[model samples]
Target: MSILFTRLRHTLLPRRNTVARPSDRIQVALLLLLLLLSLAAAAGAILLGAGIHVVESARSVEQTASRYATTAVLLADGPSPGTVGRSGTAGEPGPARATWVTRNGRRHTGDVDAPAGTVAGNEVPVWLDATGAPAERPLTPLAAAVDATAIAAGGWAAVGFLLWLAYRCAVFVLDRFRLARWK
Candidate 1:
């Protein structure tokens, strides 16, 4: 890494004896500027990803606190006819209507995605909020971490790509200028 840094430093600020043209100086400056901005962009992407993960984790915590789980009895077989076309992979669940009673002893009905192979009269676990309304399940800590990492990596990759493209264009222009000068 130190060797790489030394090389980069030399490229960006070559020895005075090696400097021959104004265009070389400009190219070095542009390269250094682009490298600095790319580093800033990568840092920004990490911060952005952390923010998203925190918000998502807080939401998940809140949902977990407010939601309760219970067994819901399916009302129809094969996840209802409407969901037949929307079925996911071989083992994924499809949408269905189910009924469940909350802690207060009041019965409620709602649409839920039941596991594949579940049939009418099968009891499936469901999540409900304090108001007896269906609620989204919370994400596990591992899942949140994975999601944040993936988002950060993708964002960083995009920034790197843009910086690389700009660097390429700058080098192309500089090469053309050098050729013209030689001519």
Candidate 2:
């Protein structure tokens, strides 16, 4: 620990024997500024995570209030027809026709996604909105938190990488100037 501290101290406050070059001072200042910005980015990550959680929570609350789960019997096969999301890629779950009773005690039949290889007459649980329409499952709090964390981590990593690239470019320019002076 002491060895690490010594290295850090030296790196942050190197001993100077003579007047420092203007370029050297500028480089140091810019590095310090980048460090400060990195700290701010860390804080921003937390705020972003909190924002994600809040949005997901509100959506879950709305879904739970407006939707209810009901048991449904498969009319044909498992899985639904067409793509399930924006990507237009079908998941392992296939499309099938299922029948269930709504909250108002009305019988309804619709197409829903079911486990692969599911046959007709198989009973399955499905979510329905207040209007007796089929609805997707709501995101859970845990899932929201995980997604937020991943996104924040990716953001921080990107910032760090950009800073490193900028530092390398600065070093290259400073080296070129020093070489020109020597020549």
Candidate 3:
């Protein structure tokens, strides 16, 4: 492994007692610049992802803090083929009428997504907002982590692609110039 690395390192360095071609030098410089830019972009992407995660987590905590969880009894059968979401996809949970009691002991009835074929009187978990209305569950920590990682990876990949593109274009132009000079 060490020998392989030394060989790789030596391949990039100018050999002694020989003059390197200007075009080769320019290619190497552009490659190094691309590497630097990729590193900088990775750092920036990580920071942005971290900031987003922090903000999202804080908001999740704040929103879920006052909200409480309880069970809602289904008031009807879960959505059937005719009552699927707008896209009309099957197998996905669909909204069904339900009733639940809030943290303040107030009773309320509304719609909640329950698994297909759920029958009336079946109990399902429900999240209630501060106003004591049924609401979506708060964002979980796993979701925040996944969101941050995806954003960071996407940002880094986009920057890396642009830098690579720039490097290729520069090398292409340099090669053409060198060819013209040689002719």
Candidate 4:
């Protein structure tokens, strides 16, 4: 089959006569495969990252639509200093009993984040979901883009490393085969 291919190739394009060994053919095939894998890895990483960014951006928009920011009046003193809250950080704000008025003029009382050792009647900023419950702020567009870019770069680097390892292994094996044949 290789002889036929060589004859066809020589006839199609005139070039200096040179025999292509089976090992050389195999090596050339592997090189082409490696190039294809590298390209695929790059494209896949970029596509996945773009998908993540789109999903995150849409989620941010949905959350922003149903969430709002408001101020709440503390009904009781916050946790004493040096006490960690849910976030496990003593310096971070702790949940405290607080009351706030909603846009519909309805009164609500719930737990809200306030600085440690906060006195009663102090006002603190908070975000409320559609149900008027304390909630987290929505993700911003800039944050989504940053997350996507980081994912894309990390994924590409990881795949590129693997591809490099494969290339190294292939070279080692092919070189050994060539050396053994020569010997």
The candidate scoring highest on TM-score is 3
Question: lDDT per residue, candidate 3, 52-143, as tens digits?
Answer: 89988887788779677899999998866545565667756888899988877888988988887788999988888899887788888778
lDDT of 4 at 173: 94
Worst 10 residues of 1 by lDDT: 80-89
User: Could you estimate the TM-score for every candidate?
Assistant: 0.79, 0.81, 0.85, 0.72
- lDDT per residue, candidate 4, 5-122, as tens digits? 9976654444335566666666666767887898998999999899999998998899889899999999999887788777787767887899998878889998998888888999
Q: In candidate 2, which residue pairs clash?
A: 79-94, 79-95, 80-94, 80-95
What's the residue-level lDDT of 67 in candidate 1?
88
Ranking by lDDT: 4, 3, 1, 2
List residue ranges in candidate 3 displaced over 4 A.
1-7, 15-19, 81-84
Backbone collisions counted per model: 0, 4, 0, 0
Q: In model 4, which regions exceed 4 Å deviation?
A: 1-32, 172-183
**lDDT winner, 1 or 4:** 4
* Candidate 2 C-alpha lDDT tens digits along 1-183: 999999666555656763567677677777888899888888998788788778877877777788888888898877544445335555567667888889889998888878766778888878888888778876666777788888888888888889889988998999899889879
lDDT by residue (tens digit), candidate 1, 42-123: 8998998898899878876777788888889999764433343453445567767889899999999878778877898999
lDDT of candidate 4 at residue 4, scale 0 to 100: 100
* True-vs-predicted CA distance for residue 157, candidate 4, Å: 2.2
